[model samples]
Target: MNQPEILQLFRVEEKRSKSSLRQLFAVVWAQLKMMLAYKSWLVMDLLSTLASVVMYYFVGLQVDPHQLSRSGWGTSYLAFSLVGVATSNYLWACLTRLSHSIQHEIRGGTLETIAVTPINMLMFFIGLTARGYLVSLIYLVGVFTVGVYGLGAKLSFTPQSLFVFIILFVLMLVSNQALGLVAAGIIMVYKRGDPLVFILAAVNEFLAGVLYPLELLKRFPALQVLSMLFPYTYALDGMRRVLILGASVFDVNVLTDILVLGVFSMLLVPLGLKMLGWGYDRIRREGTTSSY
Candidate 1:
């Protein structure tokens, strides 16, 4: 190719890469700024974490912490519950934003502005999501650190377990996005989404073997299979196995978890984008795009 043509192509590629990076960071930074603006809300959020920890401690006193220890689950209930908290937060961040975010922006007149932007719509949505997702992750880290140091609980910071944990963490994010995409679709079409947001959140927290063992779901085969498909199930279990149980990366069902999460991500992205596009088209055709 000619020098001018080659230079033009390079410029185009470079711009695309820059735009992608910018979108990613922009979404995360915007959420952080918004969170910062509400100092009281942040305080409340932190306090809520503390409150949960206290409640857990009180209940731990009532029950035997060694119960899980005997089951070969983990060393302590605190270790078990902290991992649950982290995974649950990640799922909540992804699903909550997916279902309500666009509707929220649309009602606030922000959607109109976002729709007019020159960037790719999917990229923009992802950027917007990255904002809250990162904040939630930061909150999770704070909770974990406090649980480890403040409580003086045993936590593994081993390189091998850390590697496995990172892999599961990413898988968890992707699976969370799948649920988010479905919620976004419902919001776009129905104006009000299905009441599954709260239900899903509850399940992620209570059922997905987050605070307890998957064996608890054994009697309910359907529930077991359903929870098995959930990324939170693998994530909470994997975290406990690695960080508390001192298990190796090769010791857990890492492969199966990754496969399920990968499949969910592959399906959700295109579905979400299509849903958003369809919602936009429906609004345009019906001339209801502007009406909140």
Candidate 2:
């Protein structure tokens, strides 16, 4: 190719990348604005989170401090539960956003329009769910602030610990997105109920240690094996150790947790994307992309 032609191609590629980025940002921004406009819902969400913290705080008070200390999570059950709750918030956000996006578009008669668009499906879904992720982060912060300052829960953190926690959190999000994509893919083909999402949520809540410690399940070999299959188990456990126990990322157990989470993200993300694309193609071929 001529030098001028090569430069022209490079410029064209740059412009395309910029355009895709802009489209992603535009989708995220639109959802953010819609979230802000719903003032009452935001208020209720905050209030409900605070109420849960209060309930947990009281429950913590009833438990013996020595017992919690023996558990080795920390001296505070409130702090332990706060981390679980925060992680669960992210889970709820991921499942709801991804699983519902395709369904919502179909129900609103916009799926066909969206499907026909030139936008990347993964990027489009990421942008559409960005707002929910932001809201979930807000909820997490509010819960932590109330738990620590208002409810007398003690939380220990260092810069390194915080950085590691952030890394684990991002990995958790990616892993959850993988499951979300799978759920979305199933929805696209089935065109109706969300059995995958519901079943996974219920199973994770019990097995992944959302409301309790994974250590509690260790006595049951079968249950522990089942828990190990879910990525959230490692994510939540690692986060709790880092945030509540102030463990370093380099700690042997923590490192293993990180590796497990990384593997889950790496494996599940591609598989989920492939499954989603396959389902999308099937729906389009069958002339049911817009069906509900």
Please report the candidate that would top TM-score against the real structure.
2
Worst 10 residues of 2 by lDDT: 10-19
lDDT of 1 at 107: 80
Clash pairs (backbone) in predicted model 2: none
Model 2: lDDT equals 0.83
Q: lDDT per residue, candidate 1, 84-190, as tens digits?
A: 77667778878877557777777887777766656666766776676567667777877787778777667787898789888878877876776777677667767
Error of 2 at 200 (Å): 0.5
Instruction: In candidate 1, list every pair of residues with a backbone clash.
Output: 27-131, 28-131
Which candidate comes out best when scored by lDDT? 2
lDDT of model number 1: 0.72
TM accuracy, model 1:
0.84
